[model samples]
Target: MDLDSAFAALGDPVRRSLVARLAHGDATVGELAAPFDLTSQAISHHVGVLRRCGLVEQRREGTRRPCRLRTDQLALLSTWIDDQRRTWADRLDALEQHLTDEGADR
Candidate 1:
C-alpha cells in the first residue's frame, strides 16, 4: 500500500469519520453516510479514495456491498508511526545525555 495515499485519503474529516465507524465493524455505504450531511455520491467518492489507497475494501454479499477497514494496512501505518517515534526518542535521549555530560565537565 502507498503510505502517502493512505495518509492523504485520511486527511479529510469525512473520510476519517468513515474509517472510525468501520473500526466498530463493517458497514454498508448507506450506513456509513447516515452520520454525515454529504450526499451518497460524495460518500462513495470518499470510499473510493480509501479503496484506491488499500485502506478500505468493498466485498459483495448477495448484492449488498459492505466496506471493511483493512487491518493489515492500518498495522503498516501504525508500524511506520512507531518506527518514527523510536527514532526520535533515541535521538532525543542521545542529545540529553550529551548535554548532561557537557554540564558535568564544566
Candidate 2:
C-alpha cells in the first residue's frame, strides 16, 4: 500500500466523504455523487484518486461499475497508527520514570 498517496488522497474532504460513504456498502458513481452538488465527472475524478491510492476499487456489475472500499489498506493504516501510539506511550512512561528518579535523588 502506498501510504503517502493514500494520505494525500484522503486529505480532500470530498475524497474523505467518498471513503466514508463507501464504508457502508458499494456504490456506483451516480449514487456516490447524488448528495454532492458536483458533477458526476468530478466525483469520478475523486474516485480515480482513491483508486490510484489503493483505497477504493471499482468492479463491473452488468453495465454499472460499483466502487468498494479496500478495507485491507485501511487496516494497514490503522496498524501504523496503533504502532505509533504504542511507541509514544512507551516513551512517555520512560520519561516519567526518569523524572521521578531525578526528583528522588535531589
Best by lDDT: 2
Model 1 gets an lDDT of: 0.95
- The pairs that clash in candidate 1 are none
Off by over 4 Å in 1: none
Candidate 2 to truth, TM: 0.94
Candidate 2 local Cα displacement, residue 101, angstroms = 1.7
- Report per-prediction Cα RMSD to one decimal: 0.8, 0.9
lDDT of 2: 0.97
**Deviation from native of the Cα of residue 48 in model 1, angstroms:** 0.4
User: Which regions in candidate 2 have their CA more than 4 angstroms from the true location?
Assistant: none
Total backbone collisions, model 2: 0
Give the alpha-carbon lDDT of every model.
0.95, 0.97
